[model samples]
Target: MTPPAVVEIDHRDPALQAAFCDYVPRVFRTVDFRRWCEWGEWNDDYRAFAVLDEGRVVANASVMRMRLRIEGREVIGYQLGAVGCVPSHRGRGLSRGVMSAALESCGEAPVLLFANKNVLGFYPRFGFKPWEQALFGAAFHAVPGGEPAPVLDLVEAHVREGLVSLSEEGLAVTERFGSRGHARIASWYAANAFSRPLRQLHADAWVFAGVENGTLYIDDIFAREPFDPRPHIPRLIDQPITAVHFGFTPERWWPWAGVAGEDSEAYLFVRNLGPPSGPHRFPVMART
Candidate 1:
């Protein structure tokens, strides 16, 4: 068998980067390639690894530098995404080679990823173990005399600035959870998740959300201080939302009235390179 050449492309190289983006859709057709490229937190530091067979890109993996709060301290973390292998190259070990390269680059930093159901057994070979995640859902209610919350376009500059403020505040509160690691929100996350920021009654507070299937998903709630989201829920959504779902749990809040459900589509797996700890929990917003 002929060996495939493996190379890492810097996102700054326009020609190589465009080819990488174009290749991803062959495996993941559910998302709009152009928009998916714009989604998530990406920067010049991000590395895209590809396996070239006779100079054509076939297998790919993405390694991203991320910040996470670990054991009450801010630390650099890594996330792996965009893992795919062209259909014709399925049994070539190209996907494994690309992932090995991505994990090697992570070194000792903690690594996390969401894997498709079919590939759930693939990551275990690399020391990654499946972790159960809890999803909380509750019936939506209206607050008397509440005004509708305006949805701001995340692509706009001013709106992104506001999201930054909320994210910073949210991170600060996340520290109090100690021992849990949460991915810090980047400016591009809003675009990736198609999130909108809603105005809160409290000055400088905002709720980030996205809608699907008549349900409003609360990605994250940010405020100068921790506060109850129930009171502001009515004003934060304009549609006749059937229920409100918590994506990530903020400090001091638990889904007491909500039912817990398991995520059957995607499974979270982690390979801890740092200290040995118990199962870690991250909010839905942190899912990359």
Candidate 2:
């Protein structure tokens, strides 16, 4: 009998892409499969590996190429995401084969992934160790009455330049603390990370935030100068915002909040294909 072939599929191939998209819903019930399919439109740099059984995709893994600033130096790396196997194929080792193939293709680049608690014991076989890093950010009470930040068209050169400055500063802070950071922000990432039509509260500030459950979640913020959340928090959304939470640890602590220690989640893991480094922080925008 011929064994199922495991190979990397070109995302541009519509037929294979559709098959891969179709397989996702079968393995993971919680995700919006339609939105997951739309992810391919903004992300062109990813490669999908699949295990085909009888001409159908039965297992899949996605590897996304990313440019990261590790210890103040820019390095190319890969992020592993959307790893799954069909229920009937679970015990057959198809996922292991597909993951092994994907890692082999990356050569010497570092790979990062967020695994669920259920699979905590699985990634260790691939040399992925638990990454324990602190989550720092402040909680702010909505002050109300300030003008909202202007929505910058990220496609424009000047707007992009402004965002780039913020990214550099953010990297500098991470580098100071002996952590790695992502150097460049792709337009596709911004469009997906932030809301569609990409809105910002300040003209000069590049803050990627969303309002949920009456709490504003600040995912990422970058500005040429120090950003004060005071003015823009209130006007971020028309509905009354009770508080704001940040994903990154701000350089300057806001008076309205205090830093507290919290245990890191066990699902976050990393495999260093090169030299070993100290504790590192992954940007919230990069999380799958």
Tens digits of per-residue lDDT, candidate 2, 108-220, equal 88887878777888889999887675555455556446676566665465665565566555533233122233323334455434433335655545666667777776656
* Candidate that would win on TM-score: 1
Candidate 2 C-alpha error for residue 216, in Å: 3.7
lDDT (0 to 1) per candidate:
0.64, 0.62
Supply the TM-score for candidate 2: 0.74
Q: Write the per-residue lDDT of candidate 1 for residues 1-288, one digit (tens) a residue.
A: 655567898755666776787787788875323553454334554788899765567998887676666557776777787898989989988998899888988997788888988888899999988776556677765433466666666566566656656665554434421222222333345545545554455656666665666677776665666677676666766556677776653334443535447655548787884432433335555565
Off by over 4 Å in 1: 1-3, 36-41, 53-56, 138-140, 168-203, 210-216, 239-243, 253-259, 273-281
